[model samples]
Target: MHVPDGFINAPVSVAAGVVAAGAVAVSLRGARRELDEATAPLAGLVAAFIFAVQMLNFPVAAGTSGHLLGGALAAILVGPYTGVLCISVVLLMQGILFADGGLTALGVNITVMGVVTVVVAYALFRGLVKVLPRKRGSVTVASFAAALISVPAAACVFTAIYAIGGTTDVPVGKVLTAMVGVHVLIGIGEAVITMLTVGAVVAVRPDLVYGARGLAAPLKLRVGGELVDAPAARPVPVAARSPRAVWATGLVTALVLAGFVSFYASASPDGLEKVAADKGIDKNVEEHAAKDSPLADYGVKDITDARISGGLAGVIGVGVTVVAGTGIFWSVRRRRTTDAAPTHVPESV
Candidate 1:
């Protein structure tokens, strides 16, 4: 959930912000190890896809709705480090450009929504894959479970934060119970989305899915009535899996979802916003810093038609997020190049 400004005290907010910054810094370095010529573009598309799916909020309970968190999906599609970056970028873009999330309390969003989700989901995914049968189906199953748990874990974290810094005088127990209860329903949607998306990518390009790596069972062979396992081999580099086709397909899908499909997204407040309103936590909410922006609230300023305005906003968001994500990933990739230096000369020469 995006914690708006004034929800948390200044000291806690600043502290969370610092933690978010440090997580991003660490992710950038880790991403350098994960990105390459081919998967670099995939990283950007993953961000765009997350942005798109987030627009389509599904009904979770009696008047409560939720959307894909995308941490597990992104971590499975790209690497975990890059997954964290993708969500962070989306959160940042939404806060600054769309006025969806809060700018002042961005750190809480990143910490709870970005880092915590990735860590919890990926860990659960890995744990499941290790014990389950090493098959493609197992990967998908693990993904579903991982995604299911991550949302509630994130909710717990937010509950703790609210306990420490909530502006309202509401009891912490009520907040925690309501937050966890609603988010668990939300987690079901997250799990399904994560499973389907991961299954699709793993089916076509398992090598590109970081979480699926090393999960492939060794090729078994029967030689003269004796069964034996094939020797271990490193997987093909993700760059060899063909990037242009996937990138093109992903871009088209993003365009379709944002430009046309978004018209059908649920017309209800998401889990956090609804809870805040009902629980009196939203009383102190401040106006978004970017409220005056033309593209604020996911609508074009001058576009009269609701469909057209929202469509334009979605398209623009996809384009900007993809460009921004690609640029950040490429920069991280480039930093790994070995520094040029003078060659040593032999003393005899």
Candidate 2:
């Protein structure tokens, strides 16, 4: 959920800011290892895709809808560290460009929406992959389960944060109950989206899926009525299938989702808003910082037509987020280069 400015007190807000900053810093280093020519570009596309899918909010319960949080999806599609950055980038873009989330509460939003979700979801994902049957479908199953757990985990974290720094004096127990209960339903949507998306990607390019790496079981063959593992069979990465083609396809998919499909998103309150209203958590909700910007509220300034304004905003957001995400990931790839620089052995040798 995108926390508003006044929802949390200044001290707690700033503390969360520090926590968010530290998380980003750690992710930056860890992402370096995961970012390369093969994966760096995917990172940008993943962020843009998450931004797009988040626009298509599906109805969860009465008066409540939910959207892809993208922590599990991104972690499965890309890597966990990059997944954190991906969600963080989306949160930043939504706050600054769309005026959906507040600038002052950026840290709170990232902590709950990015860091917590990625950490919790990735952990569950890895655990499930280990215990479940090591098949392509298992990855989808793990992605679903992990994403399901992550949403409620994030809700619990928010309840705790509110308990400590909530501006209003709502009953913490009530808030917790409402938050967890509603988000559990929301989590199902998250799981389905995650599973379908991961399954689709794996079907096309399993290598692009970070969690699918090293999951290639030895090929089994029937030799003279005996079932035996083939000695020549080897893991084939999605990149080996066609790296450029995969990147192009991913970019196209991202654009389609953001440019056109997002326009028809359900216009209803999301899980957080519904819960907040029901539990009296909105009493201290503050305004967004960029609420008056030209593109504020996901509308282009000076555009009268709702479709055109929203479409342009969505397009601009996708373009800007992809560019910004690509920049971050490209820099990560470059760091990987510098970290493993070839030792000097000039022609003089």
Candidate 3:
């Protein structure tokens, strides 16, 4: 959920900001090991795709809708540290460019939607994969289960944050119950989307799926009536396609989803909005600082046709987010490469 300004007081907001900053810092360091030549570009595409899919909000309960939080999907497809950065990029873009989330509450949104979701979902996903059958299908199952739990976990975190710094006086227990209840329904949608997306990626390129790496069943050999590890298989040379092809395909898909498909998203309030209204959480909500921008509210300024305005805005958002995300990841990859480069010492004369 995109928390708007005035929902939390200044002190708590600043505290969340510090927490968000620390999380991003830690993720940056961890991402160095996660992003390589094959996966670094995919990370950017993942961010753009998440930004696109989030635009297509599906109906959850009566008069309520929800969209992909992208933490599980990203973590399963990419890596957890990179997943956090991906979502944080999307939230930043939405807040500054689309005015979808408030600038003042950026930290709150990042903490709930980015850090908490990624941490909880990825941890659960790893655990489930370990216990479940080590197959491609198991990865999808784990992705679903992880995503399902992450949404409610995020809701609980938000509720706790609100309890501490909520602008309005309301029954914390009621808010917690309602938030968890509605998000559970929303979680179903999240699980399905995550499973389908992760499954698709695993089918095409399991190597690219961070969670699916090294999941192939180990080879076994029988020696002296006992089972033992077999020698490593020879590397097979398949007709390899360039990563550019995959990146191009992913970018095209993102554009299609955001540019046209988003037009059909449900108009009802999302889980967060509905709960906020029901619990009086929006009583002190303030206007977004970027509300008057040209691309504010996901529409181009002075554009009469709703379809064209929204379509242009969506396309622009995808373009900008992809570029920004790619730049960030490329720099991270470069830093990693530079760090890994060998350093030579001068010979003693």
Q: Relative to the unseen true structure, what is the C-alpha lDDT of residue 340 in candidate 3, on a scale of 0 to 100?
A: 94
User: Tens digits of per-residue lDDT for model 1 on 1-349?
Assistant: 7788878888889899999999999998888888877788789999998998888889898788899888888887787899999999999899998998888899999999999999999998888989999888999999999999999999999989999888889888888888999999999999999998888888887777888888878898899999899877775665566767768888988888887888888878888888898899998999899999888988999999999999999999999999999988888777754422356788995
How many angstroms is residue 205 displaced in model 3 relative to the true structure, after the best TM-score fit? 0.3
lDDT, residue 341, model 1: 38
Best by lDDT: 3
User: Model 2: which ten-residue window has the lowest total lDDT?
Assistant: 233-242
User: Across residues 28-132, which tens digit of lDDT does each residue of candidate 2 receive?
Assistant: 999998877878988998899899888888887778888888888988888889999999999999988889877888899999999999999999999988988
- Regions of model 1 farther than 4 Å from truth: 231-240, 339-349
User: Which lDDT values do the candidates have, in the order given?
Assistant: 0.88, 0.88, 0.92
Candidate RMSDs in order: 2.2, 2.2, 1.7
Cα-lDDT of candidate 3:
0.92
Candidate 1: worst-modelled 10 consecutive residues by lDDT: 335-344
Q: How high is each candidate's TM-score? A: 0.94, 0.94, 0.96
Candidate 3 stretches with Cα past 4 Å from truth are 221-230, 235-241
- What does candidate 3's lDDT look like per residue over 112-136, in tens digits? 9999999999999999889998889
Alpha carbon lDDT of residue 165, candidate 2? 94
Summed backbone clashes in each candidate are: 0, 1, 0
How many angstroms is residue 241 displaced in model 2 relative to the true structure, after the best TM-score fit?
3.9
